[model samples]
Target chain A: MLKKSGTTLIEIMIALFVLASAMIPIASIMGYGGRATSKDARRILAMQLLDKTLRQMLQADYDEIPIGKNIQNGFEGIALGDVTAGQDKGFSFNISLDSEYVNPVKFKYRGVGVNRPTFKADSPVGDDFLPEETISLNDVVIKLTVTVTWNEQQNLPVSVSAMTYRADFQRRTG
Target chain B: MHYLDAKRSGMALIIVLTLATGILILGISYINTIRKQSGRNTIELGAIQADLLAEGLTQIAMLKFKEIPGPLYYAYIAHVKGNTSQPYSVYHGDAILGGKLDSPFNAEFRTTFQLLSSKMYQDMNVKITVEVEVSRPDGEKYQRLIERTVSGSRRPAF
Candidate 1:
C-alpha cells in the first residue's frame, strides 16, 4: 500500500500564523502613506494663498503702501477680505499706523533698516523710525500674515507671516 | 486519515484568501490618498500664478487710467484662446510655465488716466481688472477674477 506524507492540522495552523505576522508591517506602511499625502496637500494650499496676498501688496503704488493710510483702520482691516464680522475666510490680516514714539518697533524689535539692499532713505516719513537718531519723520509698518484652518475636528491651523517697515528720510534726487 | 488531512488543507486555504482580501482594500485606500494630494498641488500652483498675473494687471492699470476710472469694475479676464472660461479643473492648474494657461490671460486695460496736478488734489477712482486662467499640465482649464478700485490723491501726504 502507498501512503501519502501529508501535513497534520497543527502544521497548517502554524504556517498561517507566520504568514499573517509577516503581513503586519506592510499594512502599517500603507496606512502611514495615506496620512502623509493629506498633510502635504494642505501645506501647499497655505503657501499659495500667502504668496497671492503678498504679491498684491507689492504691486501697489509706492504711495499706496500701508504707511499713514490706515484711514479709519480700513487699510489695517484690509488684511482679510470681507468688511464686517461673519465674513471670515480661513484667514485674517490687519495693519496699524502710529508714531514710532507711541510704540517703537524695528530699530529694536527685528533689527531691520540696516540690512543690505536698504533704500537710500529717499521717501519721506513723519516720525523718526530710529528715535535715537537725529532725523524725525514718519515710519510705515506693514504686518502681514495668513492663517489656514481645516474643517476637521480639532485640527490645528497653520500660518505664515511677513513683517517689514518703511523708514523716514528724504532721498536727494539727482 | 486522508479525509482529516484534506479538511485541514481547506482551512488553511481560506485563511490565506482572507488576508489577500484585506491587502487589496488597503491598497485602494492608499491610492485614493495620493490622488487627493495631487489635486491640492494643482490648486496651490494655480493660486500663486494667479496672484502674479494680478500684480501685473494692477501695475498696468496704475500706468494707464480711464478719464472716469470707476473704482468698482476695473480688472482683467484670463481664459483659454480656443475654449471659454470654466471654474476649477484639477488637471489644468499649472501657471508657472508660459503655457496655455498664460495664453488666455491677455491684457485688456483702460485708455484714459486721471492726471493729478499740484495745488488741486482730486479723489482719483480707477477700476482695475485682472483675470487668471489656470492651465494645468494634464489638459485642464480654470479662471479667477479680481476687481479693485484705487483712489489716488495729488498732494504729498502729512
Candidate 2:
C-alpha cells in the first residue's frame, strides 16, 4: 500500500476509455475501406464491361452494332434486376477518320452551340492528333473511359472513372 | 487522495483523445471510400452511354448512305449529342466517307469523326466512329474515342 504499484481502477478505466476512443476512428477507417473495396471492384467490372462491348462492336458488322439509347436500356429492352435506370453503367463507342477531324464539334452529335471550329490537322485541335488514317482502327487508336458514381452528400454525387484506348485495327481491304 | 484524483483525470483525458483520433481516422476512410465509389459509378454509366452513341452513329450513317443513290458517295455530316448541356453542332461531310467540316476545336477531345472509306468492306462491312468526351462537373475534361469497324456477309438460308 505504501509503494504505489499496479494499475488503479481509475487508470484501468482511463486506459479503456483511450482504447475505446482510438477504436472509433479505426472503425470509421474500416468502414471507408469497405466502401473503397466496393469502388475498386466496381471499377474493374466497369472496365471489363466496356472492353467487352468495344470488342464485340469491333468484330461485328456495321448493322449488327447496337445503336442509340438501346445499349443504355440494356442488352434487353429493360434494366437488369436490382439495377435501376440511373444506376446503369453505360459505354460510348465512336469510330472516326480524317474527314471527321476537320470539324469535330460539328461532327459529334453532342457538341452544340457552334458551326465549325477549324483547327489545323496538326495542332492539338487538328488532324495529326489521332493517327493519320491508320491502316485500320487498330492503327487509329480507340479510347474508353469508365465511370461509376454514387451520391454521398446531397445530390452532388461523386464519380470515379477509368479510361483506356485500343490501337486502331489495321484496315483489311482486298 | 488529491494525487490519485489527478492521475485518474489525466488518464481519462488520454482515453478521450485516443478515441477521438480513432473515430477521425475511420470517418476519413469512410469518406474516401464513398468518394471513390461515386467516381466509379460515374465511369460505368458514361461508358455505357458512349457505346450506344457509337452504334447510333453507324446506324444513322447506314440509313443516310442508303438514301444517296450513287456509289461515289458524298460527305454526310453526323451530329450527335454528348454530355447533355451542349447544343447539337453540325458535321457536314461526304455522304460516303463522311468528312468533317474542319473546325478549330480541341483535336483529341473536341474533334468529331466522319467516315472516309472508299467502299464498303466486302460489300457488307460498315465502319463508323463516335467521339466521347469525359467532362466532370468539377471542370476536368477527358476524351474517349470509340470506333466500330464491323464486317458483314450474306445471312445463311435456314
Candidate 3:
C-alpha cells in the first residue's frame, strides 16, 4: 500500500509541473496587454490636452495673445497645484507663438497666376491658385505650437505636440 | 491493485488536461479583449485627427477668403449654384500641415460658402462651411464638419 501511494503522489506532482509551465507565458501576455492599454489611455489624454490648448490660442484675440514659452497652461479650468500634487497625477503643457507680418501686395504679386481652363462663374478652381485681394492692413500671421508632456504607467515620459496658424486681419472702413 | 493504480493516474491526467484547457481559454479571451480595446483606441485617435484637420482646413479657407479680392462674389456664386448646401471638394491629398499626428494619413477637404444679407453696402456676410475626412492606416475613417460666418468689407475689385 505504501508503494502504491508513492506512485500516485509522483503522478500528481508531474501534472502540477505541466500546468505551471503553461501559465507563465499566459501571465506575461496579460501583463503586456495591461501595459499597452494604459499607455494608449495616457496618449489619448495628452492629445486632448494639446487640442484644447490650440483651440484656446486660436480663439484668443491676436493682440491679447502673449508670446514666449509656458505662457498658457493646457488645462485651463484645472488648478496647477492640484494636478501636480501626486506622482503621475497629470500633465503639463507649454504654448509658444511665432509671429510674422506679411505684405499682401508683395505676397500676391509674387504668385505666378495660372488661369484654370475649366473655370466657371460658380465653380472656382483651387483657391490657392486664385488671385487674392490686397488687404489695407498688413497681415500678422501667428504660428502657435502647443506641447504636452505626461508620465506613463512606469513613469515613462511621453509627449505630444500640435501646431496651428492664426491670421490677424480686420476690415478697414473709409 | 494494478487496476486501482491505473485508475488514479487516469484521474490525475484528466485534471491536468482540464486545468490546461481552462488556462488556454482564459488567455485567448484576454487577448481578444486587448485587441478590441486597441481598435477602440485607434478609432478614437482617428476621430480626433479628423476634427483637427477640419479645424485647420476651416482656417485655411478663411485665410483664402481674406486673400481673395471678391469674397462676397464667391460666396454669392456658391450660393446661387446651390453648392453651399453641399460640400465642394477643395483639396485631397496626404499632406500633414500645421497639426500633430506624425503618421501620414489620407486627407480630403470640402468647402462651401453662403452669402448673408447685410445692411451695410461695404460689409459682406459670408458663411463658410468646411468638411474634412481622414483615413487611418488600418482602413478606419473619420470625418468632421465646421462652419463659420465671416463679415468683412468688400473690396472694389469685386
Candidate 4:
C-alpha cells in the first residue's frame, strides 16, 4: 500500500498556475519599461534634429531665409532606413522665420552740426541737439524657430523645439 | 504510505518557494536598472534644454545690443576720449533682455557685456555673457553660462 513518490497532477498544475501568474506581471513591467526607453530614444533624436536645423537656419543669410512656416516630411542624413512618404522615421520637421518691426530708439547727436557732434554745446544740447534719427533696427532681427514632432507609441504625439533670433546687420529690408 | 505522501508534498512546496524567490529577485533588479536608466535620460535631457536656453538668451541679448547701437557707440567714443565716467549701464544694464520663456520651461537669466575692443572707427566688439538658471518641475536645477562675441556697427539713419 505505498503511496505515489512524485508530485500529483493537481500539485503540478497548481505550481504551473502560480508561476504563470507571477510571470505575467513581470512581463508587463518589462514591456512598459521597454516602451519608455524607446520613447526617450525618439525624443533625443528629435531634439538633435531640431538643434541641428536651428543652427543651420542661424547661419543662413537673413534675406535668404524664407519668411513663413514650412513643413518637411523628415530629417535628412539620419539613416533610420526605409521611411514612408510624408514621414521620415515617423518624424516631421517644421521651420519658420518671422519678421516684425521693433520700436525705434530715437538717438540725438549732441551738437549743432552732424560731424564731430560730441563737442560740449554752449546751449542745452537736449533742446538744440540734432534731429532725432530713427534707424530701422527691426530688419536686422528675425525670429527663427525649428520644431520636430513624432508620434510615439499609442499615437501619442511628442515634440522638441529650439528657437533663437537671427540678425543680419548688413541686410535692411525695412 | 502516509509518510511517503507527506515527503513528496514537502519537496514540491520547497521547489515552488525557491523558484518564486528567484523570480522576484530578478524582477526587482531589472526594475531597478530600468529606473536608473530613466533617471540618466532625464538628466541628459535637462542638460540639452539648459544649453539651448542659454544660447537663445544670448541671441536675445545680442538683439538688445543691436537696439542700442547708437548709444553704445557714442558711449564707447566718449570713454576713449578721456571720459572717466563709463555710461554703459545707462544703455545696457544687467539682465539686458529677460523673461521670454515659453511654458514648461522655467529659467532666469542675467546678461553682462564687456567691450573687448573699441578701436577707433572700427566696429565695437562686445563680449556678451549670459548666465542661466533653470529649474524643472522634477526638482532638477541646472545652471549654464554662454559667451558670444558680437560686432556692433551703428546702423545708418534712414
Candidate 5:
C-alpha cells in the first residue's frame, strides 16, 4: 500500500487566496469609515462657529443692522476689533443687509348692476369689474443675511448662510 | 479508502470557507455601526448649539431693555416704526461691551422690540425678538431666533 502524504502546496495556496480576498474588502471598509468620521468632525466644528456668529448678530441692536453691501470685520459700522482677523487665524464671515417695506393689498367694490339692462351688456358690472390693488405698508421690513466661510481639512472651502426679517410695528404708550 | 480521503478533504475546504465568510460579515457590520454612531452624534451636537445660541441672544436683548429708560425706549420704538426707509439704531456687541475678542468666527445679531398692547397708567408689554447668525472661517453658518415678552411701567416709579 502507498503511504499517505501531508497536504499539497496547492491546497495551501488556495486557502491563502480565499483569506486575502475576504480581508481586502474588510480593510477598505474600515478605511472608508475612518475618513467619514473625520469629515463629520470638521462639519460639527464649522456648525458651532456659525451658531456663535448668528448669536452675536441677534444680540445686536435692530437699527444698527449693516445693510446693502457686505460688511466685514464690523457690526453696524463698529470695528469688530480682532475678530475681523479671522482669515489670518482660522475663519472669517460677511454680513449683508437688504431692506424693504411690505406692501398691503386693497380690494375695490364694483356695483353688481350695470347701466344697461342687457345681461351681456359690453362688460360685466359691479364686483365682477373690480380689480385687486396693492399699497405700501410704510413699515420698515429689513432682511439680514449672514454668510460664514471656512476651510475644511486645510484645503476645502465650506460656507453657511442664515437670513432673518425685522419689521417695525406700532408701540403702545400709556 | 480513496473515497473516504476525498470526502475528508472536501469537508476541510468547506470549514475554511465558512470561517472566512463569518469574519468578513462581522467586520462589515462593525464598520457600518460606527458610521451610524458618528452621524447621530454630529446631529445632536448641532441641535444643542442652536438652542444655546437662541437662549443667549434672548438674555442679551432683555439686558438691553432694562438699561434704557421708559421714555427713551418708547421714543426709540417710535423712530423705528415711523422711519421705514432709514436704518434704525442698533446695538453692537463690540461697541457696547468693548474689548471684544478678535476671533476667526464672525457674528451678527439683530434684535427688535414690538409693543404688543398697553393702557395708560398700566404696564406696557412688548415682544422682543432676537435674530443671530454666525459665520465660521471655513464658511459654515448657523442661525437662531429668540423671542420674549416683557412688561414695564410706562414711567419709572423712581
Candidate 6:
C-alpha cells in the first residue's frame, strides 16, 4: 500500500528562515522611506521660510537694514503664520550682514555738491574742493546671509543657508 | 516512502526560492524609485536657489547703479562718445558682479549691463541681466537668468 509522508521539521524551519531574511531588507527600506519623506517635508518648509525672509531683507532700505547677525527662535510662527495658542515653535533663522568697501575711482574734477549750512566762525573752514579719492558712505557692499536650522527625529541638526550681496545704492529717497 | 518525502521537500524549496526572489525584486525597485525621487527634489531645490540668487543679483546691480549713478552715467556717455581714455569711462568691468555668494551649495554669477536710453528729458534706464548658475546637491548644475531695468530717479550731474 502507498503511504503519504509529512514534511519534516527541518524543511519547515529552513523555508521560514528564507522568508524572514528576505523580509528584513524590505522592512528596513520601508522605515528609511518614511524617514526620508519626513526630512523632505521639513526641507520644503525651510526653503519657503528662507525665501520669504530673504525677500524682506532685500526689499528693506539699505541704510535701514540691520547690520551684524541676529537670531530668532520659533521663527516659523513669527515669519510664517500664527501658531496654536500663541506658541512659538519650529525652526530658527539667523540673518547677518557684512559690509565691505567697493572703491570707485575718484575724479579730480568736482561736480555739484550738497549745499552746507553756514557754520559759526569758530569752526575751521574746510576745503572748498571735495577731497580726491575719498569714498562715500554709500560706496559699500553688504553681504546678507539667511540660514534656517532645525532638529530631526534623532536630534540630528539640519541647516540650510542662502547668501547674496546688497550694495548700498543710496537709491531710496525720503 | 523515501521518494514521496524527497518530492515534498523539493516543492518546499521551489516555493521558498520564488518568494525570496519576488521580495528581492520588490525591494530593489522601491529603492530605485526612492533614489529617483530624492534626485528630483535636489534638482528642484537647486533651481529655486539659482532663481532666487539671480533675483538678488539683479537687485544688487540696481543698487550699484543707484550708488554710483554719476560714474556709471559718465561711463556710458564716454562709451557712446568713443572716449575710452576719460576717467570713469569703463563700465568698471565686472566689478558689480559680486562673484560667488555663500550658500549651502555652489553658485556663481555673471552679469551684463545695457544702457537703454540717454535721450533728453527722459529717465536714463539701465537694463541688468543676471545669470546665476548653481550646482545641485545631486551633482547637477542649474542656471537662471533674471533681467531687471532700473531708471535713475534724477539725471546724474556729470
Predicted model with the maximum TM-score:
6
Residues B44-149, model 3: lDDT tens digits = 7667666765665566556655655354454344445665511122211112222234434576666665567653336667677767777777887787888889
lDDT (10s digit) by residue, model 3, range A67-143: 55544332333221113312375444333333333343122211212355655544543442344323343445555
Q: What is the C-alpha lDDT profile of model 6 across A5-54, one tens digit per residue? A: 34455666788888888888889988888877767776767667666677
- For residues A1-174, what per-residue lDDT tens digits would candidate 4 score against the true structure? 223523465577777778787888878877877877776677666667656666665566556665555434223332221222233555443332233322332222222242555554222223223443333444555655555667776777665555565656444334
Every model's TM-score: 0.41, 0.40, 0.64, 0.67, 0.48, 0.70
- What would the per-residue lDDT of candidate 4 be over residues B1-158, giving only the tens digit for each residue? 67766666755556876897798788788878877887776666567667766775676567656555545555544455555223444444433244435455777777766767665244678888887777767889888898999875545667
Largest DockQ belongs to which candidate? 6
DockQ list for all candidates: 0.04, 0.11, 0.24, 0.25, 0.07, 0.27
Q: State the lDDT of candidate 5 residue by residue for A1-174, as single tens digits.
A: 233345544565677788788888878887877877666655555555556555565556666655564556566434332233233444443333333322331111122223445423222322222232222333333444455555556577765554433433222222
RMSD each, Å: 17.2, 14.6, 7.6, 6.6, 14.8, 9.1
Fraction of native Cα-Cα interface contacts (under 8 Å, chains A and B) also present in model 2: 0.15
For candidate 3, the per-residue lDDT at B62 reads 62
Per-residue alpha-carbon lDDT of candidate 2 for residues A121-166, written as tens digits (9 for 90 to 100) = 1112222122212111111323333333444324445443333333
Winning candidate number (lDDT): 6
How high is the lDDT of residue B62 in model 2? 42
Q: Which prediction has more favorable lDDT, 3 or 6?
A: 6
Q: Rank the candidates by TM-score, best first.
A: 6, 4, 3, 5, 1, 2
lDDT of 1 at B82: 19
Better of 1 and 3 by lDDT: 3
Error of 2 at A37 (Å): 5.8
Candidate 1 recovers what fraction of true contacts? 0.06
Worst lDDT window (10 residues) for model 4 chain B?
A: B84-93
Which residue runs does candidate 4 get wrong by more than 4 Å? Answer: A4-12, A69-136, A170-174, B1-9, B35-46, B60-86, B94-96, B99-104, B150-158
- Per model, the share of native interface contacts recovered reads 0.06, 0.15, 0.25, 0.15, 0.10, 0.31
Please identify model 5 stretches exceeding 4 Å from their true place: A1-8, A68-71, A74-142, A150-156, A165-174, B1-5, B10-12, B34-120, B125-147, B156-158
